[model samples]
Target: MSDILKFPKDFYFGSATSATQSEGTFEGDGKGQDIWGKWFELEPEKFYNEVGPYKTTTMYKHYKEDIQLLKQTGHNSFRTSISWARLFPEGHGEVNEKAVAYYRDYFETLRENDIEPFVNLFHFDMPAALQDIGGWENRKVVDYFKEYAKTCFELFGDVVKKWFTFNEPIVHVEMGYLHQYHYPMKVDAALAVKVGYHTALASAYAIKEFKKLKTGGKIGIVLNLSPAYPRSNNEADLKAAEIAEAFQNKSFLDPAIKGEFNPLLIELIKKHDLMPDYDEKDLDVIKENTVDFLGVNYYQPVRVKARDSVPNPDAPFLPTYYFDIYDMPGKKMNPYRGWEIYEKGIYDIALNIKNDYGNIEWMITENGMGVQDEDRFKKDGMIEDDYRIDFYKGHLKWLHKGIQEGSNCVGYQVWTPIDCWSWLNAYKNRYGLIELDLETQERTIKKSGYWFKDLHDNNGFEL
Candidate 1:
């Protein structure tokens, strides 16, 4: 019993996937095109091997079989999103019945199998119509988003008890504005701040509207929180890391949970003369309508050292300016994907919640290693993913440690249930329990699938 790895009573175990990443038929079912659909079309060279949103695992057709695999792997819950364009073809004019029917049927299947659906409203798939209207940068998009959120609750709230406003609101802003990796990419911090502020305001409005319905469902936002680590204990390095974390993680974390913006973030915004247009009345809405829960996506921690000199004035810059990613010697790495792997990061995140963030309930919404060109593992009709299994076990150990130490973490949900398309690396990093053959739309369970079943059967895997 001492060696048994157990979670608290009713702790959840699930897997997560987004609509565009898995549900193919991007244009079928009367779905309006999203940024992914358009970007791949306008600039095919930007995508890997010219793959677009149309070619996915076809979960829209195969969810029945996929749900079976989910149950076989002992999932008590699952997370999926509603494509904004799928329901409202143009950002906010009319609802598409066909899109609703597909998701209604899809969500019902999970319930029939005793799996609770942890649904999200948006996963960065902005409708092309919205984009034409300035997307999140334009304040009008927030009202458009809130209208979409309300529709989702009215239609699917009966089944999806847990609803997330956005998968990762900060990620959308940073990648779209600061990093220039997303659609409509622009390296303008001022505009990015505007977008971030709007997304947060939209989330607050959604929670307020949700309460009016008296649906008794929980509302939350998902954030990818990578704890920042200083390369050394030096004060300059440490301060830089703190600012980096505040900008990246706490910018969303504070407002979503604590109902207030961190002062440190406010200072940076002011220093850069990038104050978002915020009405005085908006502060009350944010404070009063904080999320009931949090969904944290932890992949890897960032190790940074302070810049020796000011960043190149002419070079493209982002909030990551105060520090640079330091490649520390002897740091463990996943050789297949080239991402650093440190299990302790999970434990530290949990503790931060308990000690600094007021012990709010949270779930590990996404955690998995993405391996490039995993086709070599395809043999005997199954992808033998021993490495993936090891990755899961290692993270679980730290998560278990978090529970033992009395953090308020409630569950763990892996990055994906089946291999799907990521933002830039389309089908490059395979991080799924069920290996999907993109050609035939066939899915085969790897060894990890069976191992998870055993873990779930026993209420925990052996530590």
Candidate 2:
């Protein structure tokens, strides 16, 4: 290991987490219920071990201690989201001053500790109040979101220099509308189209509002970009791969970064009569406001192939009508999460952004391996997760190459910092640098945490 992979001096190193995922006291201190809270109430069985958001890592009460752990784990920067429901209990009108004060203190604490805070506005936790009124499906809720964004900027803009409008905007579309995995689950293709469109529109409106206040902060959206690879070079396989990329990757990327919707996607929606209701005003908003930078979360690539079986014409529509997921034989697997592990996928994603998107400034916002029953690997009070360190090294090698080739990639933030309650999956899969003892609510740094500290201090590591 003589040759060290030295990153640029300015490259940021940190971990990412979300408010709903880390903050346990959801109902106290003027915090209102978000969609997750309501969903857990209605269908508790859907969640792993019946462990809902309420059983998280208690960041609200333990933020100070948590921030110390962040520093100890060698985070020069960190990403977390603000709960909209916490700020506006009803998602509109009067603001909750407690929420305001809490966030201000949170951001200031990070700044005081020499850790930059990258705050995101929405992270799949919609206000329960907003959901009762159709959520993203109704155009009215878009305006409500704009107001919420404006309020967040007015309150915390000074302390937070980096802000994101939303995280993984496509997940809501795919889960809530197309698949039945999320709340208000409805398997409707047209509604999926509508939801996806309004999400983009809402993000643009937030960007527009952020600029209006002149906060002097950089605003962007966090997207989980999974590159699509064809199983073979056949024309049908290529076509399948293209459509998968269009729907999953570019749906939000083009509008958020390029300030325009992909015409090919529009054509597909139109062909299926799934076109969403929209007007010129929203289009103008999207066109005028593109992101200042991009936050990418890449877990795995989507392997696609031509649909072998004809779909029943009578059946309802789906984005997969033109293509289907192809499972390549003998691919490496992260058995805990059942996700394929292809380190080179990160490289392909970086190169695509460099050549196609003008190499816009970006960072690896979320990338880490999730393991189940992690205690099985615990040794001498620390979880020996060498697999996680290897995972990071493999991905970082490609990321470093991307930067060397002139891609404007600035940072690498793992999926999370402290082990916390995850959505639906609960604690089934752990992706934390520090282990959280759920029973005692104690925090212990893991082996990877120490490895990360050294890597951050050295600005790189031996390959």
Query: What local distance difference test score does each model get?
Result: 0.88, 0.92
Model 2 residue runs over 4 Å out of place are: none
lDDT of 2 by residue, 71-146 (tens): 9999999999999999988989888898888899999999999999999999998999999988989889889999
Candidate 2, position 156, lDDT: 85
Span of 10 residues, lowest total lDDT, candidate 2: 23-32
Off by over 4 Å in 1: 26-28, 313-317
Clashing pairs in 1: none
If scored against the real structure, what TM-score would every candidate get? 0.97, 0.99
Best by TM-score: 2
lDDT of 1 by residue, 1-463 (tens): 5687787888788889999999987445898999988988889888887788887888988889999999988799899999999899998989999988989999999999999999998999999999998999898998998889888888888888999999988888988988878988888888899999998998998998898887877999999989999989999999989998988799989999899999999998898788988897888988999999999998899888898778877665477678888889999898867879999999999999989888888889999988877778777777778888888889999999998998988888887888998767788778888888888878888777777777677778776
Give per-candidate clash totals: 0, 0
lDDT of model 1 at position 6: 80
Q: What is the lDDT of residue 255 in candidate 1?
A: 92
